[model samples]
Structures are given as C-alpha cells and as structure tokens.
Target: MPLQPSSAGTWLRAVLLAGVVVLLVSLIVAIILGASALTGGKQESSPKMLKWKDRGTTRNLQEVILGRCYSYVTAHYPELRDKDCLKIWESLKHAFIYKNPCNITAEDYQPLMELASHPIPCNKSLFWSKTNDLVHRYTKSNHNFLTLEDTLLGYMADRISWCGDPSAPGINYESCPKRSECESNPSSVFWKKASKMFAEAACGVVQVMLNGSVETGAFRSSSIFGSIEISNLNPDKVSAVQIWLMHDIGGPQSESCSGHSIKRLKGVLEERNFKITCEENHRPVQLLQCVNNPDHADCRLCSSNVETP
Candidate 1:
C-alpha cells in the first residue's frame, strides 16, 4: 500500500495523529528548513536544499553522526522495546529523512554528502550496488548499518496512556478490545503509549530508509514499510511503526496509499563549493551513491561533474 503525509503543521503533529510513512520526506524537508539559521522569514514549508562549500567534509560529518547513532541503537535495541526510546526516534528519523528513489536528485546536493570536503577515499560500491560483499562487510544492508535507533528512545511518555470512556471512532484499534481504549476526545493513556512506539518506529524506519540505497548520510531507510507483515494484529489498534508508515506513505491530504517510495534512493548532493549543473527537472536528494567501472581513474574524482562513466 502507499503512504501519505499529514496536513498537520509540524512533524510532531503527524506523530500525535499516528500517521507515519511520509515522515521520511517530511523530515528531510523539515531538516532542510530546521537546520538552517535563517529561512528569510519563510516557514519550514519551503526549505532550501543547499549544499555546503565543503560538501565532502559535511558529508563525512553526517556519516559520522549516523555511524555513532547507529552504534548506539544496536547497543540498546533490547532496552528500547522494554521501555520507550525506540519508537520516538524512529518517528523522528522517518519524519525527516527517507524518500522515494526516483525523486532523488544528485543534480542539486551531491557534494555535501562526501566523507571529506575534498573527496579522498570514498567508494560508493556497497551503498549503490547492494551486492553481497557490501552487505556482509557493512551489516546485512547499508540502510540498517548506517542508522542508529538512539533517537527513537527520545519520545517515551513516563506514564501509560489509556482511554477511559470507551467509545468508537473512525480509526480502529488492532489490539485494544474497546474503541474507547483509543478514543479521540481525551485520548487514552494506553493508546498514547502504543502510539509512541508506532511513531518512534516510523521515524526510525524513515531515517533508515533515507540512508539505505542512495542517501548515505546516516545509514539508510528502506521502502520496506509496504512489505511489513502486520496482518496478525486486530483491525482496531494500529501498531506504532505501522501507523508511522501509513501516515508517511499516505498523508492526511492524500486519498489513498499511492505515492513515491524511498527505495534505492540517495540524498547526497555537492555542497555550494562544487558547481552543480542539474537537469531541468530535479528534486531534493537524500543519499549519494554511484555505480561505476573500477578501471577508470575519472570514477574516483569527486569533482568530475558528469555522472560516472
């Protein structure tokens, strides 16, 4: 199924509504705006996806940030499920990163994602090819290895939220016995806790998806939300991850699950320093991996304007 975005003003609102999938793009879009010191009085809606002058260095910094974050998550995955953390971080990442592969644009922002400001020894084979060697050497997949679940742990509610009045609403609960368990008016503590997990998972998945194929900033987020087998649950209560994915792929404004995906895409773009001559039709990018033939020295040069030959 396809996912959608939330009309809600902020990414946080999307979570509260339990919407997921689109967060990947939303987050990337959000960060494009959030990270900036000035939007020229413009709101977070239209973020300028710009590359830094030392794009290569910034790319490396992003990689480092992702690496540290991923390491932290693997170390604490067990702890996350038992408590809170995992879900929120997942939602956070999803809200900002992951995106559809086709919309990926190297035209605008490829240089900044490099491991160095001046590109030294960066081989994008594993990230771009998805081959066995890369998988074995860099986790089962670049997406999983590069991102960390650390952020998900950030949004845990201290108390378990429960809906007391018990009523039915448009949305169904997968696990809760009564609609009141997840009612809207006051909302439920029980539902809130569950929503937290769903939101976090969504966010985490989004981030991972972003880094998975093309966007090498963190690890990678995949378009795996569609393949996730969540049929075993009740139709009523939605899972946190599921909710996040659904909202992410299908937004509040969207009619159904039909939209772009975050599969095999890259967000890496050259920073401002590099001269970027993009095609007429270009979208903001999230990763930056490339396929190439090893014999050519030109392939190694980061400043080589044209696509690798």
Candidate 2:
C-alpha cells in the first residue's frame, strides 16, 4: 500500500537533519579547541594597548597622550600629521642613536604589577574619595577634570614610585611580592597593581564619550567606592582595582559607551591613526585609530570580555 506523505512527517525529517548538522559542527569545534589546549595556546587575548599606554611618566601628559593624539591628529588633519607626528616618529629614530646596551639606561616606568590573584575590594565610597580628590583640583567648570588616560597615567606614575621595587630584578612578572611583611614568613602575590588604573581609565573614557564630561550629582564618588580606600600614601601596595564605584556614572546602563568599549576607544582618537591588529585563528581584524594607545594602555592589547574568532 502506497502511503501519502503528511506535513508532520516531512517536518520531522527536516528537524532530524538539522540536529545531525549541529552535532557535527559541535564535534569540529571541540576538536579545534582541544588542539589549542594541547598546544598551550591562550583561550583569548589580552589587550596590547593597555600595556604600551601604561608606560612613561605620569606627570608628562605629552608622552601619555602622544601615542593616541598623533594618530588622531594625523589621520584627521594630514598637514598637521606631517608637521607634528611624522617629525616626532622619524627624528627620534634617525637622531637618537645609542650604540650599545648601556645607552638603554633610561628606565621603563611601571606603576604596579600584580603577583597575587586577590580581587581588589571596591564598592562606592572609596571611589568617591578618589574622584573628589581629582575634582577638587579642577578649575570649577568641568566635573570630570581629567581624561581617562590622564587619571590612569597619574595613578600609575604614583604607584610605580611608591609600590614597585625597581631594585628587584624583573623576572617572572607573577612572582613579585607586593606588601612587605616582617613576621609573616616568605609570601608572594600576583597580578600587579594595574587594575585600579584600568578602572579609572575605563570609567573616565566612558564618561567623556557619553556625557562629554562628568555630570554633577550623577554618582557620588563615595557611593561608588563604598568602604574601599583609594589612598596612595599607605605603607602597603595596592592589591585590587574595580570599576563598580566610579563617580559620575549616570547609570540606567549608560548609553555612553554602549557599542563595544574598543569602538569607544577608536572614537576617542582623532587624527593620525595606527595599525591595531587583533587576530584570532585564521581570521584577523585590523583597526585604524587616531593614535596608537599602546604607550598608555594597561594591557599589551585592549579587548573586552567579548569573544571573537
């Protein structure tokens, strides 16, 4: 007997085919991930921009801004790019010649490097204290007196001078002891003191990008940091950093930096741009921004938790 095909029967067949396809795709992905794990490959990337940007003197705003400012000014204003940045990048190379190792005597500035996994305890009150401190120094017009980069650079410079043991040889970045102890035996810490710098920088950038400045009474610096202290003169080194308590965070999930933190970063840059390369597997994405932030960033590359491949 010949049976007529029903719509339900045909739908069932299609669904089964789809399931098979999905299972096969999953298998392939699992294999690839296994290979990566076996090779000791990183599951994801850390931003290079953060590392480079975090270098240099905190007081010297010129060096801090130079990396990104040049790219922005150059790409946006071609004549200025030729007159300013091109001259800087070129002359420094052609003129400043150090023949040997001793010439590399100029010390690289480092703010804080974590050697412990302890998360920085931050809420609101602590952040407010820090923000108010910055605001107090402002000339009374802007609530947010410093740019994200400015705050981070300042904090980092202060941190390196205070917390870091430059006398200690730069060996495994993860094994350096932060807080000194007398009777606690030989202890170690990891993940240096860069987190606070990141939180400050990230918050400031977001505020400017969204509101063009910090809004008055938007978020009290105290409320942002809660019980955490943002002091720098303490006898101990900073162990944690958090973004939860930044002042001027007009929440409701701010519309300021909505489209990817990286994009906001790109938008902040204006003229002379540089090659920002982010590669995952066979696929590679390139970004051109006003300035190369590598000099002032906390990580070697700048990437959010968002995964791409």
Candidate 3:
C-alpha cells in the first residue's frame, strides 16, 4: 500500500494534533484538582485555628492598640508624646506571638513594659482589690489619686482580652485562657508585671482601698495587691500605707479595721518596716458612694440623727 508523499504528511499531522489535545486536557485536570485540595484544607482548618478557650482573643487587636497608644500619648499622657506607638506594638507582638497561650511569662512583657512606662507621681497612687468599680469612681471624682488602670501601661489594654497562637495568623480570635486556667497567660502576666512596676514606683503616702464586705476579709495573700504590689513597695520611699476599708452603703460589713485579715496585712507592713494606717468607712470615699444612695442611713449626716424631744 505505497501512498503518495502528500497523504503520508497529512496522516502525521493528524497524530500530532491528537497528542497536543490530550496534553492540554491533562494539564487542566491537574490544575482543577490542586485548587480543590487547597480550598478543602482551608475549610477543614478554619474553626480549629480560630477557636478560643473563653472570650476569644479580642477582635481588631492591632487597631485597638494603636488607637489607644495614640490617644494616650496625645491626650491622656502628654509626657509620652515622644513614645513610638508602632514600636510599642511591635514589642507587645513579639512577646506572645508564636508562643503557646499557656506558657507566656511575665518576663515576656518586659520590653512592652519599658516602652509604656512613665513616672507615677508620689502620694497619688491608689491600689484596690474587690472594689474595682467604687475605686475607679473615687479616683474619677477625687482627681487626687490614680489607680494602676489609670496609668499608661494599663490604660492601653484595660477591659480587653487578647492572646496568641503558635501557628499561622499568630493570634487566636476565638478565645483566651482564663486567669484560673493559665496563671501565666499573656493578660495575667502583663497585669502582674504592670502591677509590680506601679507598686514599686509609688512613693510618699499611698492609698489602698479594700472591700470590707468580702467574706474572706479585706486582704488576701494571693491578691495582686497583696502578692505583687505589697512585696515591691519600698519603705524608704513610702512614708505610710494608708488603708481605706470601704463597704457598700447600707451593706453588711463582714470585715473591719481590726479583722483577722487586716491584722495580717499590718503585720506584713510592719515586718517590711513601713508605717501603716487603717480607716473604716474613709469619709471622702464614703461621701462619693452616697451620691446615688442619699437616703441610705450610712449616707445620712450625723446631725440628722439627733434625738427629738
């Protein structure tokens, strides 16, 4: 079957065209399969990667930090106007990023602490335990005292939660470990470190507002105030530790100036060679609490209690 040269050439061209079509089809199939695999992986991993243990890592963490930093330097703390917010954020990031949520230590936040530190004026420090709301209210109204939360180091992250992961995205947006779950969690570590610094810097006469209504008494050996702040206080700089035992207006007073806990606190201070003073229902703070409960007996003026004929 000898064929013409032109016919043989046409037959060869048909075979080449068929081979090209097969190669193109195989390439398209491979691309589709690869894309599908990537998408499926992302779908399978989304929840686990983002899951949290309690309230997840705070959303918009970077934005919130930057905003707070700028606001602090520009408004709340004009003295810190020269601070680099970006650098502060970077310091915070490096401390916890790619680290296990349960393993972050107080030392990890040292860089951030240094970046945000400022001198707390003497005699203006106000420490509190179990009286968060009232203590803050007293500070706002008095303007003569400042709590740790009022300072630059605490102001930037107060009332917010945040944590990191050892994986990609770095931060877990689902939840962070509770303080009880991980004592060394990022938030807990930060406050412990911050509280220590605040206590150490306090000088002259300092105030501590404690809740007298706490059943366990006003002072606890485990509290930040008792544990971190108390140990860090310098007797040479501090003339006295003024303790204000405040109870809710018209509320049951479970503890007092002479309660077992108060005596223990006194012992600690005396052992440390620092003068201590205790005042139950400190007048100034009591007056502030009475603003909303003017009718309460505790809020009534002593003169109004005079016996009638």
Best by lDDT: 3
Candidate order by decreasing lDDT: 3, 2, 1
TM-score against truth, every candidate: 0.17, 0.20, 0.86
Residue 96 lDDT (model 1)? 21
lDDT of each: 0.25, 0.29, 0.86
Provide the global lDDT of candidate 2 against the true structure. Answer: 0.29
Candidate 3 off by > 4 Å: 1-47, 50-52, 302-309
Q: Per-residue lDDT tens digits of candidate 3, residues 1-309?
A: 898999999999999999999999999999888887988835344434535458977788888899999998998778889999999989988998877888998889988998889988999999999999999988878878999998877888889888888877888887788887878888889999999999999999999999999888899999999999999998999998888888888788898788899989999999998888888888888888888898988888612111111
**Local accuracy of candidate 2 as per-residue lDDT tens digits, 1-309:** 655678779888999999999999999999998989987975755422111112222333235335544554455334434335333433222211221111211111121121111122222112223343333233123333333223322222233211121222211122222233211111111111232343432311122111112433222323222212222212123222222122122223222222343343333231113222211111111011102333443223533332221
* Candidate ordering by TM-score (highest first): 3, 2, 1
Q: Residue-wise lDDT of candidate 1 within 1-309, one digit each (tens)?
A: 433454335666767566556756787888777666476655566332222111111222233444444554456343323332333334322322323211223321222211111111111111112222322333322433321111322112112111111122211122212333222221222223332333322311121122122222211233121222122112222211111111111113221111223211211212111111221001111112223233343234423111110
- Candidate 1 regions with alpha-carbon error over 4 angstroms: 1-200, 208-223, 227-299, 303-309
Better of 2 and 3 by TM-score: 3
RMSD of each: 30.3, 26.8, 5.5
